[model samples]
Target: MLETLLTHVASAAEATGETTEASGDIMSSLGIDWQMLAFQIIGFALIVFLLGKFVFPILLRSIDERNAKIEEGLKAAREAEDNATKAQSKIDDQLAEARREAKEIVATAKDEATAMLSKADEKAKQNAKHVLDQAHDEISKEVIAAKKALHNETLELVASATERVIGKTHSAKADKAVIAEALKGADK
Candidate 1:
């Protein structure tokens, strides 16, 4: 395999008219000295190192600052959301408190109304009792008066009937007794 590769290389070199294997001639034909190429590569490497230390660091710092700003914005948004949640809770608490107060007020009003109705009913019952007592007393007095008047009238009728039957007037003592009896009945 090595012999085959060497023969191919020799054939290719002959075809390209390369009769000598010299590194200097190859370098000179390419217009590059190996020592100068090495120095130029070193200079490029130094320049890349300087840029990585100074300019690249500035770029990395800017990227880090941008990322920090994004993180701060996210934190602020989370804080705002928390504040909103607290505000909503406060509003809900206020609403619940208001509802409780309203219920208490309504209950108080209902109690007052019930008390008023109860008082009115008590007053009505008392008034009805007073009127009934007055009516009963008046009826008892009227019944006694009527009984006295009826007794007097019955005595007068009996005296007139005796006068018509015997043709004589009643005695004053008998009339006095009849009037006294009528008065006694009225007392009872």
Candidate 2:
């Protein structure tokens, strides 16, 4: 190294046509070591080449595989979540339909019940009216029978009293006429 520095100094002095302490001082103050710099650059290149050829490819491949697996997992999770949401939506739609059907069924049942109740009330009213009419008819018949029985009894009593007063019995035809005339005057 010293020989190289001396040769560089001699060449520089020849070129400048002067020999100065300042030139040597300037070269030294720059603090550059050419051989060491070349060795450091070569070492750095070798380290870079080794890492790129051996270590970097392996690490990069592992990172790519990991990325692909993570992406696939994320896609599967999204699909599962979407399917769950769709299933829930379908269930909710079915539930809403069931509720609507239930409401319709309840309304139909209520309407049918109301109709049946109305019919029953109408039937009951008709039955009551029929019973009242029959009772009135029966009462009328009984009243007519009572009036005819009283008329017959009154006729018989009058006929027997006449027989006692006149000291004689009468023919059926004559008794009928006399009873009828007495009944007429009594009715007036």
Question: Model 1 Cα displacement at 50 (Å)?
Answer: 11
Candidate 1 per-residue lDDT, tens place, 77-141, comes to 99999999999999999999999999999999999999999999999999999999999999999
TM-score attained by model 2: 0.62
lDDT of each: 0.83, 0.83
Model 2, which residues run further than 4 Å from truth? 1-41, 164-188
* Top-TM-score candidate index: 2
lDDT of candidate 2? 0.83
Worst 10 residues of 2 by lDDT: 13-22
TM-score of each: 0.51, 0.62
Q: For every candidate structure, what is the RMSD over all alpha carbons to the true structure, in angstroms?
A: 13.4, 9.8
- When summed lDDT is taken over every stretch of 10 residues in candidate 1, the lowest stretch is 12-21
